[model samples]
Target: EPEVTQTPSHQVTQMGQEVILRCVPISNHLYFYWYRQILGQKVEFLVSFYNNEISEKSEIFDDQFSVERPDGSNFTLKIRSTKLEDSAMYFCASGRDSNTEAFFGQGTRLTVV
Candidate 1:
């Protein structure tokens, strides 16, 4: 199975630092999304990007965050300024369509110090 890949399963950064989390979504998929979980908190959707433009985005996706498909197979999320609350498990997911099943990556655990 061709799965979504994320680098550096764990990351430690000081508050206010810049961080870019990388992910390689499924090749044949059309929709990509970013979600996060704050330790024991419920999973929250941050943004959804399709056709090179943002399809939907939650309030959490503020100015500090940005996403881009740098290449055919690479999707990346960048945090211009990391906050203490930014520490969470960032997940990259992809689906064939809005109603289809989405597959999640193992997740990139960001720790802000």
Candidate 2:
């Protein structure tokens, strides 16, 4: 079945550099969300967006992180200044509606060195 796919499956970056993780979400879904799992911690919601403007974002999605559609099929997350604490598996999710279950991508492992 068609699903979201992320590039570079794993990324290694320095403590203070830029990185952009890419994703291709399900074509028909509307609501999009970004989540991060730090090793064994609970999956934390970073942000949720619909129609471009952010609908909701948690404290984790601070000024250093930004998300964008860029084009029709791609969704990207950019970390302007990476930190060692930012190492985690970042997942992109999509749902048909606001209250529906979201399907998550395999995830892009971000490892800040």
Candidate 3:
């Protein structure tokens, strides 16, 4: 069985710092996405990437955030600047295609103080 893996399951940072969350999805998956859940809030979609470019993005993925596939095996999300409101659990997910099942990583809990 294949699954998505995320590093540094927990992270703590200052309000104005920067953070990079990493994830590795199943080898054969073709669609990748980043989603987040703020404490006590609903899960929200951030952005989707495919064919090495952004396919879709939500309002939450503003100028402060960026996604990259630095190589064939890893995907990364970088936040240029962190804010107290940026604290949340970020999940990395991948699917075989647009209509298939998507596997989600355990998530990286980010806390900004």
Each prediction's whole-model lDDT (CA): 0.95, 0.92, 0.96
Per-candidate total of colliding backbone pairs: 0, 0, 0
**How much is 7 displaced in model 3, in angstroms?**
0.8
Over 4 Å off in model 2, which ranges?
none
* TM-score, predicted candidate 1 vs. hidden true structure: 0.98
| CA deviation > 4 Å runs, candidate 1 | none
How much does candidate 2 score in TM-score?
A: 0.97
Score every model by TM-score: 0.98, 0.97, 0.98
Candidate 1 local lDDT, residue 52: 95
Residue-by-residue lDDT tens digits, candidate 1, 1-113 = 89999987999999999999999999899999999999999999999999998999999999999999988788999999899999999999999899999999999999999
Return the candidate ranking by lDDT, descending.
3, 1, 2
Write the residue-wise lDDT of candidate 2 on 1-113 in tens digits: 97988887999999999999998889998888899999999999999988977899999999999999989678888999999999999999988899889999999999999
Off by over 4 Å in 3: none
Report how far residue 44 has shifted in candidate 2, in Å.
0.4
